[model samples]
Target: MGRWEPNARGRLEQAALELYAERGYEQTPVAEITRRAGLTERTFFRHFADKREVLFAGSGRLAELCAGAVAAAPAAATPMDAAVAALYAAAGVFEERGDLVRLRQSVIDANAELQERELTKLATLSGALAEALRDRGTDDLTARLTAEAAVAVLKVAFEHWIHGSGEQTLRHLLGECVDSLGTAVARGPGAAGSVSG
Candidate 1:
């Protein structure tokens, strides 16, 4: 691809991913990424703050999508239901970019810095979901807890999707995780017929 190509941002992202996978995230530099993409350093800077940003660029969009879904959910939906619905909304994006998502995960898995960045992004998403839930009239504590739990569900489902066999979609895994959470919550600490305050 030429530097003047239409998808300069995409070209930069693809190039960064390829380099990150092959050379490792910390080992790869912005210059090499721009060169691989046939783009100038100026162009790379135009689209991303740095090499690491390439891997995390979509986080903003993902947060927006999840928060929007939460905000748009039916008024009668419970906080958990609305939050999980956001996960379902995000599933479509993950499903559409399965290969790239897996590759990106692999890159992050290999680098401690990237892993921390990933966690930070997830926390931001959780905050966004919590704010959306509050906007829906959920109380502060309930909204925060529900959002945190929903983000946990997302993390678990994503791990399973990336590591498990290709039989189940991300959406299916998310549902399974949500069901498991519900079961555990329902059983409580006294499921064996014992009660403790």
Candidate 2:
């Protein structure tokens, strides 16, 4: 096992998020986040690059988890299966923090800069997944397309997860989103007309 401080990083992130909501992301300094977390500013720098990094810390970890999942997927798995596996990897990284995600989402919702950073993070995750799939012998086109679809599913599933009961798992929500996507694709665009009948 490695060094762990009872989730000091988690505490700092949660504190920063709460402060972002109350004080605005720009207004909240690193010192304030550390103070709120009952930690020192030195500890904050140990876990993150800067104040802006608090909202983005998960992106790197999630990308690593996704890439590892894609790399470990069975040789017989299809591109979509590999992509789904990458999405499944998110459960371990995010499932326990539905409330924290909800809070972070609210802050991002109110801040344009954070919204752009979120988009960049999603793109980075997609790129990482695509690269991992390519390493697994997937064609470039299939790998990129599957990775994008999977990342989109992750975003939508995470949106759903943050809105529902905290007890619900991220993996379960991801499965739901995947099923919904499949159903919509099977029904085609014409299915929308049926809603009025």
Candidate 3:
């Protein structure tokens, strides 16, 4: 089972997730997780800074992938396009494990603390994406708002993928959200002025 325990990090994450789901995140002890995983407490601590970090396994790496994708996008692409592309690229890492994804999501949904941590991770990812946009010459405000909007779309698309009607793929859902955002952006000042009139 050495190959199965190849990395203490993943073991800790899996153990924590299982325990969290069974006993609630707030109630699950770090000791119990390490014990259940057949690992030492020191091994768990070496991988995760704390119990909370165990719940957010892979978030940092996924954010880096997302930011890299945005930074590499063509300048001609709209901010929404860039954001959606990043999310799409990130989706590749997730699409292979639908069952694990659903289980992890369920655990997060079952706890308010986990939900807050998930939101914070998304916000951090958005900031990274905004910085990538700014590096590509977008103005700060525009980059920040565009990043926010893109993340919102990604969030909706993810939810839809997990819980919505299964007719649309996540990539297609992201593309559709981008198109809708593009329409709103195109309407711009004219749409706003007409509304006020």
Candidate 4:
């Protein structure tokens, strides 16, 4: 390989994803990933901590995007509204990647360890969102609740978007999930009380 090559990080990520899909995440080695990318293992380590990091390298940036969006929301916006804004911001990133996001999800779904890591990443994102809400003057309980609910909406919407036909965008699914959440909340305890045990 040339001493200087552009988009090394992108090449590494693409190579890793392809290898993981072809040979399974657990079975794919770092050496193989580097070889596939036409880069040295030193180059791979420069961009990522390990093979798994190839799949998750964007998590930190994603969290920052979400939290920043929540913090930048208008002062008049409700906590949930701010959280939804974060979700929309995240959707933009996923929408841009399109098939790459779907392929990454498939790779993660095929590995139990990757799935656990994905959950951990989502939990961290929820915490960052809660902190942003608190910075907006929301009370702790309200901030935590709103952030958790927003994350749940994101998770559900992402699953729907990944599995559904290509017609519906993630932003649309997120809006629908938000509406469903509102309907469920609007039903209130009385709605549940009406049902016989």
TM-score against native, each model: 0.93, 0.84, 0.86, 0.94
| Candidate 2: worst-modelled 10 consecutive residues by lDDT | 1-10
Residue 152 CA error for candidate 3 (Å)?
0.4
lDDT for position 170 in model 1: 95
Candidate whose lDDT is highest: 4
Better of 3 and 4 by TM-score: 4
Model 4: per-residue Cα lDDT over 75-166, one tens digit each: 99999999999999999999999978988999999999899999999999999999999999999999999999999999999999999887
Give lDDT tens digits, candidate 3, residues 1-197. 33435777777777888888888888988899999999988788778889987768688888899989998888899776787789898777767666667768888898887788899999999999999888888899989998899888888888988898768777888887777777767866557769766
lDDT, candidate 3, at 24: 86
Q: Rank by lDDT, highest first.
A: 4, 1, 2, 3
State the lDDT of candidate 1 residue by residue for 1-197, as single tens digits: 33466899988888889889999988888999989988888988888998888888899999999999999999999999999999999999999988889889999999998899899999999999999999999999999999999999999999999999979999999999999998877865547656543
Model 4 regions lying over 4 Å from their true place: 187-197
Task: Report the backbone clash tally of model 3.
Answer: 0
The 0-to-1 C-alpha lDDT of every candidate, in the order given, reads 0.92, 0.86, 0.83, 0.93
Which candidate leads the pack in TM-score?
Answer: 4
Model 1: what TM-score? 0.93
Could you arrange the candidates by TM-score from highest to lowest? 4, 1, 3, 2
